[model samples]
Target: MSTPVIFIHGLWLHASSWQPWADLFTEHGYQTLAPGWPGDAETVEESRANPDAIAGHGIDDVVEHFARIIKGLDTKPILVGHSFGGMIAQKLLGLDLGAAAVAIDAAQIKGVLPLPLSTLRSGFPVLSNPANSSKAVSLTPQQFRYAFGNAVSEEESQELFDKWSIPAPGKPLFEAAAANFNPHSPAKVDTANESRGPLLLIAGGKDHTVPEVVVRSTLKQYRHSHAVTDIIDFPDKAHSLTIDSGWREVAETSLTWLKEQNL
Candidate 1:
C-alpha cells in the first residue's frame, strides 16, 4: 500500500498555506492531506479582521484534530509539520499514529536542550499580554520578515505574506515553553519511543524560533526510534523554507526521505 502524508502548519498559518507542498506530494504518487487547526478562519482577510475566530486553539486541540482525520484514512500517514505544527507532529508519533514523521524547524519539546536568543525574541511579540494567552495575534510585516523569512527576498516575502499569512493563536507558543515544564501544560507530547515509525527533523539554520542548537537538542528525544532517526540542517534556509525561495529543495529532500521509507 502507498504510504499517506499529512501536512500540519504552525502558528499564523492556516492549512491552506500548505497547498503547494500538498499538491507537490500528490504529484509524487503519495496521498496527501493538510488539515487546519480548529477554528482557523476561511481566509487571511477573515483571520485578520477577527482573529477571535481562531483563538483558544492549543497543541492538544491541533493534535487531536489531525488524529481524527488519521482515523478515517485508509492507511497510516507520514506527518510533515513546521514550527508549532512540528511539535504537534511529534505528539502524533508519541501516540504511535504516524507511519513516518518529518519535523521541519520544529518547536522546542520537553527534555530537548538549548534555547536560542532568537527563539526567545520570536515570542517577544506576544509574551507579555494576558489577552494573548487566549487570543490570536497578527504579525506585522517586519515581524514576519524577522521571524520567518529573514533569508528570502522582498518579492518572495511579499508573495508569502499575501498568500499564506494570517493571524495565529498565541496559546501554543505560550504552551510550548511550558508544556514540558508545567504538569498541566497541553503542549506536552509523548514521543517516548520510536514505535510510531521512522523520523526525520529538517532544521533551518536561520530560523529565529528554532535554531540549530534547538534542533540538535531534539535528537535525544528521538533516541527511542528503531527506525532511522536523525536531523539535516539547511544552512541558508530560514523558518519559511516551505514557502520561501528554496521550497522545492526542501520538498525534494522530504520526498526523497519518504520515497526511501515506502518505495
Candidate 2:
C-alpha cells in the first residue's frame, strides 16, 4: 500500500491550501492529510479575517503539530511542505517521523546564506514594525504581487490574491534568520543527518523569495545525504507553485518521483 501523504502549509495559509494537491495524491492511491497550522481557522475567509488567532506560530509549534499527526497515521507518511512549512518538514525528518520528504519553495536552511531583496521585502510588513511581532500583519497588494505572483499573469495573480492572501505571524521569520547560531533555536533543523530519508528539494524557477542561488547553495552544503537527494527546478513558476496555473504538473512530478521510491 502507498504510504500516507502529509501536507504542511506556509505562513498566511491554512491546511486547505493543500486541498488540490491532496486530491491529486488521493487519486493516485495515496492516503492524504493536510493539518492546519496551530490556531489557524477552519476556512480561508475565517483565517484571513482573524489573523490574531494564529499569530506567534513559530517553527517548533508547527513541527510538533505535524509530528503528532504523523504519529497518528497507520504508517510512516511521505511529508511534503511549502515555504515555512518546508522548514517544519525538515525538522519533522530530523525527528525521524516520515518515510521521505519533498520540500518545495522552502525557507532558508542552516547553510543557505543568500537572502534576496524580494525575500526581505516579503517579510517587510512584519519586520519593519516592532509591534508586528505580537500580531499578524497584512501584505499590500503590490507586495504580494512582487513576492508571490510575479511569475503568473495579472488575472491569475488577482484571483490568487483575492482567495488566498492573508496576514501571518512574524515570529517564525525572525527565528529562521538566527537558527544556525543559536543551539536552542527552535527553527534549527538537522539537514546534515544522512540517515533520515530521501529528500527532494523542489524550486520554483521564478520564485523571488527562494531564488535558485539559495536552493543551489543548500544542495551543495548537503552534498553527503545517504538517501537520494535531488532538485527539480520548475521554470516559469513563482513562489506560489502549489496552487499556481501549473500546480498539477508540479504535483504529478512529485508523485512520479515518489513512485520510484517506497510508495
Candidate 3:
C-alpha cells in the first residue's frame, strides 16, 4: 500500500483549504488526509457560524487530536503541516509517530527566543485582549493581508481571505507567546530526539506572522539531534504560500523533498 500523508492546517484557515495540495499529492500516488483541529467544523461557514466550538483549544489539545488520528493509520505516515500545524507535525515526529514531516511557516515552538514586532502585530487581534484567549477570533481582510498575504497583491489577499479564512482559537497564540517562560509549555517539541524521522522546515521571508528569523530559530532547536533536519527559505513568499496562487510551487518542493528522502 502507498504511504499515507496527513496534512494539518494552522490558525484562521479551514482544513479544506489543503484540498489542492492533497489532490496533487494523491496524483503522485500517496494517500492523504487533512484533518482540522479538535473543535473545527466540517465547513468554513459552519466554523464561522459557531466560533465557540473552536474556541479555547490549546496546542496540546491539537497535538493529541492529530495523534489520535495517526494512531488509526496502518503505517507511519508523512506529515505536512502549515503554521501551527507545522508545530504539531514536529511534535508528533519527535514522538516517533511519522515517517517524515514538512513544516511550512510553522509557528514558534518552545526555546525560540526572538519575538519579532511584526509577529506581535500579526497576532495582536487576539493577543491584544486577554479575554480573547478563551474565544475564537476572526481576522479582518486587512489583518489577513498583513499577516498572511503581505507578499501578494492586495486584491489577491482579499480574495484569499474571503475564500479560506475562519475563526481561530486564541488559546494557541497565548500558549505560544508564553512558551519561552513556561517549562511545561504545550508548544514544546522534543527536538532532541535523534530517533525520529526527517524534518523539513520551509520559511517565508516576507511572512509577518512567522518571519524567516523565527523559522531559523526553530531550526536551531533541533541542533542537538542527529536526525535529519533541514530548512528552505522562500525569500519572496509570505505566510500564505500554502494557499496562494504560488501554492503549487511549495507543494511541488515538498513532494520533491519527500521523494529524495525515499519516503
Please give the CA lDDT of all the candidate structures. 0.82, 0.81, 0.96
Could you tally the backbone clashes for each prediction?
A: 0, 0, 0
Off by over 4 Å in 1: none
Task: Kindly report the root-mean-square deviation of model 2 from the true structure over all alpha carbons.
Answer: 1.5
Query: Each candidate's TM vs. the true structure?
Result: 0.94, 0.95, 0.99
Residue-level error in angstroms, candidate 1, position 259: 1.6
**RMSD (CA, Å), each prediction:** 1.6, 1.5, 0.6
Q: Pick the candidate with the highest TM-score.
A: 3
Q: Candidate 2 residues 10-114, lDDT tens each?
A: 876667879899999999898998988887888888988788888877777778788888888888889999888877787787778988889888888776778
Q: State in Å the error of residue 173, model 2.
A: 0.7
Global CA lDDT computed for model 2:
0.81
Per-residue error at 138 for model 1, in Å?
A: 0.6
The TM-score ranking, best first, is 3, 2, 1
Task: Give the higher-TM-score candidate: 2 or 3.
Answer: 3
How many clashing pairs does model 2 include?
0
List the candidate numbers ranked by lDDT, top first. 3, 1, 2
